[model samples]
Target: MYMKLKCFICGYEVYGDPLTNTQCPRCRGILAVHYTNPVFKIDSRGKGVWRYSSLLPDVGERISLGEGLTPINNVGEIYVKNERFNPTGSYADRSSAIITSVLKVRNIDTFTILYEEDFTKSLTHYTHFVGLKPSISIPRIDLVDLDDILFFISRGIDIVFDNKPLNTLVIKYLNPLTVEGLKTIAFENYESRIPVERVVVPCETGLLALSILKGFKELKERNVDVDYEVVAVSIKNRGCQLLNNVREVKVVEVGDREVFEALREAYEKGFKTKPLSALSLYIAENIGKSLAVVTMGFKTVTSRESAVKKLILEILSQGKPMTAYEIWKTKPIYTLRAVYKAIKDMENKKEICFEIVSKGRRKIKVYRLC
Candidate 1:
């Protein structure tokens, strides 16, 4: 299984360790995975993304948590790829499974992930399942809730809060393995046999968008008549450097308010997802018939000893009253709904008390320790 890493910018190719040499030696650009004598076939008996294993790299002993095969639904004329239905409640699970499988095959039992708390969670779950140890680096502990932090800690995953790079395998989007796993999303969409005019994806780093485009490219290589525009949407002021060199990609920028509105609309349509995921829906409203990938679903932090509840308790334990919004913004890792749920649950157990506070024209409920 000879795979080549080609620089997405200069087209310089190299046959080296992808885990070690992530950037191209010539152009220092991001590398994409290319298999020699690529074969495209479907194994109907395979599960999740493995159904299209013939199209993916030959990473032995497929590792999976039943990711992919997400349902595609129509909201009016727009088609939505509900990726939140993935095993870890995120599309990243698809890549995590593939990356972990590669590590397992290479006998690399340990790896580290940089940033992207959501993606880290999926990777952590898969790595742990495959008997591999994974450490994650985040900018700050406050950026994530306590439960997730504790969960990783309990799994013996080193949680580092520094810019220093670990010597071990680092699982960033730059790693072509992750992008290779993400391409399966496009394969699944193509297999659906639906008419797709365009694909609207929320772009942060743009790897997912690029992977989708690569998947379509592979389909085209297989003599499949695939014609679809790739649209990358970013929240205002956030640029996607990954899509800069990619051609024919239409980039759109939206504000925070638009994303909030999209979240509300998506919720009204029975989809409770993150703001980034909702951005796809916002773009879909403008474009005619397009496929929008809802990346993740909003979940309530229900653990009593979870970081959100612990932070709420710590705040009220000071004997100072605070509103739900105040608690939400204080340590914003937890959603407002999750905070409110924790407050109600704490109140039920007589762990906290609340009072009504009126500020100008608005009335708000404030909470404090009992």
Candidate 2:
């Protein structure tokens, strides 16, 4: 029940709440959850990452969205771990699930998130599902896509631009619970019974790479022999500091052309993934018996229908009849097709009513809440 938070750099341990004290007070290093009497056992009947609960902390109720257990595809000589199949279409769902569980167990209902690239979207979805009020901090709002921006707004998630620090739970890669969840990827890979000569991963904050290494280390501690090397690919020259001096870790930088080529190749092969994932495949192309971890996929046009429908109902509830185009321009989270689909579904359920009105020489459909 009581998991010790140990600093990754200095080995300083804290016995209190891991969620509140994310960073080591002494060395300012990131803290990792250290469990006592840790044992590795795969529950044959368990689903997703929950199968490895014996190795994870028992953080009350398990919050999951069917994350993990992604298919391992053999492309030529490399094995690609397609993580884009996760519930929220990103590997971050694994981390978000564990973090949300931890927060829920601690009776924390609201949290803040520092918005990163793909991870932010996945975190937003998970947090919303778990009934957590997420206050997001970003450098610039325009940097985020219109769909994601509207989705967050529709969910009533607060967006702020100030850099002021908050005392509430802030979701970030530095959190130990996140890393603990990510370790399941390594566990799943080890369980696949495939000969792993090398593992290729895209290194953003170095959290995923470090978590995978820790997972393999846990296996090694249990007397399971692991001989594979870790290859971290990055788009920049200077990678993350977390993997700065890690042993047997090779960091490679790839150009945009290489990333685009890998993306094209992966899409052609029926894997529509993000560029970060494509970078992993690009690095794995030169390695022998490699396993590339594809992190995320492109968001489908109609993926956020429920959220868009809720927004539409809320807009109509304000006693103003609005056209579909007006709602689309206001929310902009759902594609035109998805908005129409939600409208049709709501109309059939008698939750809303629509009327055709003529303005000038054009006729448009306007909807109002019933």
Candidate 3:
């Protein structure tokens, strides 16, 4: 028995090797990481996340960088661990490095392929630094002629996958290290400050939040005076909304069609955004179906204008709603008249149902799904 894992939902503990086991039998929830050694310490002098190697899965010649000890800064109520400071940048590398390292030690000879561009680069950089060759399977690697990405993957890169995985195992294997790496941040936070009142994490697949939860649990076991709630912020996208809803996590759907717009903007601006979740949020909101709120009182944050724009664009792009607009007062490049004009044009084409139900002296245009 090297590592111990516990169920996130039922709190059932399993004492065994981590390489073979996957799920919790008690509640069928995914098993979370738990080291057998609670008081394990690492050489802080070492470079990279490997400094905390004692807390990770047992592996040979662990991969690393000057990864951990990320700066903890406060933003209003949020305490950000500025994961952007990681060596490969972004916190994903921390997890990828650990997963790749463990697989390498197991002699799995596994290659990693990420669906995202920046992530692929991060994976390659860290894996190579750890003496493993990784590859990238660019979804559009061929659609757009690449200068460097092409040469790298062609040269026996260890991993790359662009089209989102239909298989959950691919996601799980590729992501084991991320959960492991993210745990370190929580450790540092608990040791540095009073446990947070709440943690707001930008969740793509819920792994980050899951890891945070596991890390905090570890702290609590050690008698750390830590108290906090985990809030996994999800988009109004399809895939994520469904998963989050099913998992019973609070899902906040903001914006209209602007949901997708925010995603596109984030992608174009080189920020991380999960479109699937955003799409799910949109569909759920329109249908008036929602998941339970995890806590009695909590605040949901979203940009209404951006969400509405995303909703409108999704409708127009799908050729279902004809057109859309912003009737509410807000700041954006799109003005009130532009919204109305676009709506009128689309209504004339019968691309949408244009109805103005009167609210006192004011009239509101409502577009129905066609």
Candidate 4:
């Protein structure tokens, strides 16, 4: 297992230190945590983003808000990875998970960050998950959205407006940890073994596109056969040089009118996404059999959920209160992780009830038809 913070331009490497600095001391180039020769294997026992922990840097007990493993729906011809179900309801939770974990191991008590609503809120939440304090400085709080303002206030985040945060980490594109977090989307796609020729992503600053591309690149570096090419969809010819640096990235420029047209088409097709995400939808729809990442991804697609549920139903139809593990033992397909999520959903909707039993030494939650 090889891991290091690598400078893309100067090729300087820092091993075992993701936070040595976000830039190369020699060239001041952008740094990203690079993994090679990794014993990458899907840990089915692990939950959420941590399922791919083998590919990520070792952060001793990770802090998670159930960030990854969002559902990918095959709506019409386009496959969309919906991230709306994340803990903070944003993909930034993925980055927050890694950031908080690294901070925890480093024994960093307090860290300040420049506030960008989604990332700021996510980092604040995860930091508190491990009892770490974050002071957020938003230079344009007056211009910030009303709901976002209330969110910060509700969480008791320390916010400073229109001021410089002295020597604090800026949670912006240059952040390598952000790259580490965003790249897991590509890993999820690969592990799921979803066959698609192209994967499309919305490009604002190109970090998401670059991170995902780097992930696939790492896959190729480790001799894994990767099939799809990453396509960056933008409104204008609107991407930075970093996106161009990757020779394999396919860039698509869309017209504003065309975007709106696609927006309406997507709405009628029962897909609701922001204009940025609509850009990916437009490209994916035009080129059928493509998966456009809406925001996040999941351990296994809910496409398997119905089948797994049917099996669990048959097991519990006997009216016997069986433990979740007992139900999984009868499942001929789907991972136990999938079974767990299915029962959780069923339990939530009152389709299943717990038959608590006091055993000799252990108290167990047994499931039966409600």
Candidate 5:
């Protein structure tokens, strides 16, 4: 007889074949493979994420790219697990390989990979490594400049700008195999001598957060004393609001405009939280969610480096282009040669872009988006 499988969310007993229902009918949450014993110790014979395969669903054929044992660094008080060291320089590679493997088994070759701007390179890397083809979609606003477009094209990435595909796939984009891939991170954490007090994930979407929750639950069942709060950090403007609703937490939403305005107001007047709507909202929201606010300082997008991003931000702000001189006059601090050099470095790293426009006697360089 086949083993009985159950829904991970509602714990509903799945009576029929497991392949028929991949998700729970009650809560519509993703289904997890059930075993007779919830916990079991396995030999450390296997290398990388495959060691935790016992806890994850069986993939007919495993497509792996050495996606485990990333070095964990101690940065200040927090342990910074540098996922950038992953095969594709992003944490998504682990999950991407698994997802692609499943698709290969199912003979689903031509599938679209709808992702945020950040995941484009990572996904492309993994897809190529796994020998699969995928069409990627990102926001138009996210792709700021023509040079940015060139970069994606150079990487052989097919770009589309519609949310329909994402809406269709829902969480299935993170198939069971993908979630299982994420469990590797937790497994590593459990094996560590000093367990992490809190897990911080860069969340554009909530998939990683959801996977982390599952991984921790499995660790708990294994009798690992993994007591830590899961913190999902996101950009003030680009963050997905659905995470709060899904987690059933009271969340505060903030935007870049609000943050900048507050900063400007403080510089002119005084530094206080009362005037900044975003800062105030963030304070309350962070407290409610038990999240630590970590500020990331953005380098100035200057003409020598990425005139693209600065110009894009400018155009979006008021649908008008600003010359390098105008920009310098308006924001002199950002026009520094050092700032421009840093921008150039970022561009080489494929982080942003720059464009120059010619107008009469004076040529104006405009920084575009992305």
Candidate 6:
């Protein structure tokens, strides 16, 4: 093996057959992938996370759904790394890709997983693609999200409570491969057009926060010009144990109320996000020059709609709201009917919104950039 699993804490190395568990049973430390000749170069010919395959594990075959290379959007003074663009609509696709690729190379046919809403859903998608059967076991159904239940039911995924099935690997969130998958986010940020200073991520088990920090640390250790601080936001006091020993991260505890308020603010600003990620958004707003990593959103990121819609956005973006007739006047080349049609399309997509203005006894509608 060109790469060996090394303890993230003790630096103990394991060679030969790779272990499934990321936690070192000997030192009781977390494990990470350490390559013999680790390089930090992006292959432009490759797409998505595979571009950083130099820094990633040496899987025989890479099972990818074009996860990673998510957009770093500038919203006000903060930057947003939207991970919802992944094939599974979650950042877990990164881990799922690596996990399934490893399983395929090892010729493993099936696996059992502890049900985590986003991760399980994402894993199922990849498992289905790779022709692997996976059964999920839930710790508590009542505690599970309704959307997750429906998602499984809709996909006809198996839900078995107590069948282990011999020789099947039980996937865990703490796996070293999982970190190898998620740490690519830090690589993406480092390769961003605009330099990133601090990264704010929502913490559940502290795996994600640490994975990203390790990525930046690896870059710095390799003599790459990169400097980044990671901030882990947790709800109340949940999942602060793994982070307690890590001095590289700044842990922030937020209440449920603040998270919801931030969620509302996120939607209002057209950045729909989950409650866990809302904490990062809230924290990023309070700080300066930070990138908030949001795992998913209520909608997909904006794409080019049409030429007229693009022009209309430019006009409304530079100034106040304008009526459709006024917008047509700015670009007379486009017919009045075309401008009106573009406004309707943009309105449907929520790219632009409108408000009514009262002039004398008449009411006129004006469109503004959302």
Provide TM-scores for the models: 0.77, 0.75, 0.56, 0.74, 0.56, 0.78
**Candidate 4 lDDT over residue span 306-359, tens digit each:** 777788888999988999988988764766766887888899988888977998
Per-candidate Cα lDDT values, in order, are 0.79, 0.78, 0.53, 0.76, 0.53, 0.80
Q: Give the clash count for each candidate.
A: 1, 0, 49, 4, 10, 0
| Lowest-sum lDDT 10-residue window in model 6 | 297-306
Query: Which structure is stronger by lDDT: 1 or 3?
Result: 1
Cα lDDT of model 5 by residue, 1-370, tens digit: 1335565556786754333355668876665556566564554765456667677556676666776667665422445455656765556666766665566676655656555433445555666666666666665545544544665677776666755444322223434555667667766766765544555554554556666667877778777777756666545656544355455222344566655654453332212222222243233233442222221211122342344445434543564445434544555654344345444555576654456777788766665334
Superposition error at 114 for model 5 (Å): 1.7
The 10-residue segment of model 5 with minimum total lDDT is: 291-300
lDDT of 4: 0.76
Candidate 6 vs. true structure, TM-score: 0.78
Q: Which portions of model 6 show Cα errors greater than 4 Å?
A: 1-3, 16-19, 162-167, 298-370
Model 3, position 73, has a per-residue lDDT of 48
- Name the better of 4 and 6 by lDDT: 6
Taking the tens digit of each residue's C-alpha lDDT, what string does model 2 give over 1-370? 3578887777899887666677889977778888767788889776667788887778877888888998897876888888778987778888888877787777777678888766777778877787777888887877887777887888888887867777776776578887888988888889897876889998877888878887888888887777668788887764666777566578888777888888766554445567777778877987777999888763333434566778888878888888877877777765666577677778998989989999899998898977
Q: Give per-residue CA lDDT, model 3, range 1-370, as digits (tens).
A: 2467766667688875454455667655666666665554656675576766666666665777666676654322334455656765556666767766675676554454544534555666665665666444556655433534654655556334456553322324323355687777666666566434555555555656677667777677766667766556554463232134234344444554666664553333223434533333233333331221111011122354345445454555544322144332323445554455445555677755666677689876667544
Scored by lDDT, model 6 comes in at: 0.80
Off by over 4 Å in 2: 264-271, 298-370
Residue 329 displacement (Å), model 1: 34
Could you give me the TM-score of model 3 versus the true structure? 0.56
- Evaluated with TM-score, which candidate comes out highest? 6
